[model samples]
Target: MSFYLTALLQGLCFSGIALGIYISMKIFNIPDITTDGSYTLGGVVTAVLLTHHVSGYLILPAVIIAGWIAGGMTGLIHTKLKINPLLAGILVMTALYSVNLTVMGRSNLPLVSISSIFTSLTVLADPNQNTGLILLVFVIVITLLIGYLLKTDFGIAMRATGNSESMIRALGVNTERMKIIGLALANALTAVSGYLITQFQGFADMNMGIGIVIVGLGSVIVAETLINWLRITSVWISLILVLAGAIIFQLILALTLSIGVDANLLKLVTAVFVLLIVSLPRLNRVKD
Candidate 1:
């Protein structure tokens, strides 16, 4: 039960990246691989700052800014330079590898003796419960803000830019600027996940973000399936579903591990799970 509880907390930690992928892939229709890099960027930033005695809360702004800049660079490459979106993300992600290593000055930085955001406040008796509560509140706030943003006029423009770029551009909206802002917002959220997860795990690894994008993509795919099956149209409900998707994804992984699967095969298991989720709607359509 405790193992599953920990998995649940981990899913919450990943909710940020899941939401980021929801915005970039579902909303913007871009396969922004920059997530893989920005996620690590967040962790290293947190690790470095915490080691230097900075307040956990204070470092969040820096993480957000760093993620935004990385994402904005991808957007600029794709839009202004006329490069492919996928390639632009790849370029930025590649560059971020060196950047992360340089910033951390080591491949792995442990926070074993360092205080983290979870330690800043403790209302619950059990430490796990306290962490869960903190993550829940954080996720809720972020979801609300994103949901509210998507409902505003500017937010609607961003959506329109994604749904029908030509039409939105015809209406005098600068589609490129929207893409830039959207990617920036998405990666900033991804960075927050890094911030949370590093604290939760008690260390930051240079390769921690490697293939991490798949986690977010899988969660988004789950949310997309739910959205289609339930015909959900409300922005708030859709965002909530995305959070549920992240938790569900992690639970599935936990179940796999509990069943005695080799830990080394976990990545393979993840790939297979995501493939099935991706194929489900198509399989259903075929059945129909």
Candidate 2:
């Protein structure tokens, strides 16, 4: 039970990153790979700043700002320079590799000695509450915030911009601005998740974000699949599915770990998971 709870909490914490995927994939109809690097940028920045006595409060915004810049670059490359969206993301992600390394002041950073946001929970408990509560709080806040955002006027405009960008531009909506803003916002969320992960887990490896895009997509696929299962065709239902699916996917991973699965095999697992989800719909259509 404890293990399950822990995994669920962790999943929820990381769901911010998954939500980023949701924004890019479902909202923007864009395939963004920069998340793989921006995530690490968050961790590295947070870790480096905290090591130098930077407040967690301050470090968060720092990480977010970093993510925004990275994502906006990707958008600029795609929209202004006329690069393919996917390739633009790849270019930014590749560049972030060195940037994140610079942020950490080293190849890695460990937050064991640094007081993390989750550490406060122990002051009110048996001193062994772990980081689950911290994850829960963050997840709840982010989920509510994002859900609200998607319902706002700006959110509507943003969604419309993604659906038919040229049409939006024709309506004088400045689709390029919307795309850049959405990408920045999406990646900012991802960076927040990365910051929390590093703080809670006590380490920030430069390569920490490898396969992260796949993991984020897997979480979204799981979320969307569950939404579909519930016959959910509305945006509200879609939001709920995203959070629930993140929790569910984490448990799925936990189940694998409990069965003595090697951690090294996780990439392959994520690939298979994504492949199945991507193929399932098409296969069903063929049968139909």
lDDT of 1: 0.95
**Weakest lDDT window of 10 consecutive positions for candidate 2:** 120-129
| Candidate that scores best on TM-score | 1
C-alpha lDDT of residue 90 in model 1: 97
Q: lDDT of all predictions, in order shown?
A: 0.95, 0.84
Location of the lowest summed lDDT over 10 successive residues in candidate 1:
1-10
Task: Report lDDT (Cα) of residue 279, candidate 1.
Answer: 88
Clashing pairs for model 2 are none
Tens-place lDDT per residue, model 1, 190-221, is 99999999999999999999889999999999
TM-score of every candidate relative to the true structure: 0.99, 0.93
Tens digits of per-residue lDDT for model 2 on 163-218?
A: 88778778889888888989998899999988988886788999999988887888
lDDT of 2: 0.84
- Determine the backbone clash count of candidate 2: 0
